[model samples]
Target: MSRPRCERCLRAQDHCLCPLIPHLQSRTRVVVLQHPSERLHALNTARLATLGLVNAELRVGEVFADLDQLLATPGYRPVLLFPGEQAQALVGYAQEGCELPFMLIVPDGTWRKARKLLYLNPLLGELPRVTLGQVLPSRYRLRKAPEAGALSTLEAVVQGLNVLEAPGCFDQLLRPFEALIEGQIRAMGRETFERNHGGR
Candidate 1:
């Protein structure tokens, strides 16, 4: 039989993450487009990010029918948090003297799946793309990063917000993510984690 779960954080009731989740607010809005494949993953950090941030939302899908309406949200400039040759550093937005806040649209999935999100949503590809200046190392100990400086969805969102807002402004957002990671490491046995990932 399956174990009981927390209605909110979805962890097993005994291992609930609800207590660590914060209800913090940010000037920049965060919208995470998560692929369905990641919805039930043991370490779905995207969900934690949305739950912690007051001005965030999580949408699960391969293709969104109302993406146009979603992107058209007023008073905030929509920007894709993806890297590319044309992508500008997010820090530059402030220097450019743009007064509007940003609606950070982040794709939450594997590299290929995230790219699929962009391919499937042509409108997302048209947005101004922004990249972080200097990315910190990922704290997602359970999974290997696809490339250098890659981060989990929650980490990416926190870094993006830190760049857009003030440094350390979104640090509290990582509490649950960290707790979840620690919990996983414990569940896996420290010997196992140390044996598998300690050298990295």
Candidate 2:
């Protein structure tokens, strides 16, 4: 029997959910700094962020070597997303009332690699860090992390936007993600059903 194709986008050639794309507008731009390794994975949620938000940008790199240049582009305020006792929280930027739009810099990788990226990039160290406080549970089942509250890229973006009271701006992006997961589950169930009933 031939391998079943992914049902979400119906791309036997590739897992492309391009048809289910959602376009959203936001006052806050999301900049996802995906680790080079995670870019190609079919399940990477950063891609969801890129597809969901009109203002979202996804840049894959091993480190933040060019982060300053990236941030210097027009209409972007880059903020590092990291949690630490010594780190100044996300609230600092809000209190300052900086007029520029904020860009949430999320490190997409294992905890260790994320830490390495933080340390290797001097520009990242200089930027104000924002740590989310809601502590929501993660929805990503395929990847495991030590922190139960650690969220996928899409979830983090949602939470961040909601915190800024711009939920409607990126709310559409959530639909495609839900559809993708649902499609995958339904496909698996169909395969199971067919296998069990095929000989009957």
Top candidate when judged by TM-score against the true structure: 1
Alpha-carbon error at 163 in model 2, in Å?
A: 1.1
Query: Using Cα atoms with residue i matched to residue i, what is each candidate's TM-score against the true structure?
Result: 0.95, 0.75
User: Could you give candidate 2's per-residue lDDT for residues 25-51 as a string of tens digits?
Assistant: 777878887778776565667877776
Could you tell me the lDDT of residue 102 within candidate 2?
79
> Across residues 136-178, which tens digit of lDDT does each residue of candidate 1 receive?
9999888788789999999999988887876447888899998
Residue 151 lDDT, candidate 1, scale 0-100: 95
Model 2 Cα displacement at 65 (Å)? 4.0
Where model 1 places Cα greater than 4 Å from the true spot, the runs are 92-94
lDDT for each candidate structure:
0.90, 0.68
Question: Candidate 2: misplaced stretches above 4 Å?
Answer: 1-15, 87-98, 141-145, 167-169, 187-200
Error of 1 at 8 (Å): 1.1
Measured by lDDT, the strongest candidate is 1
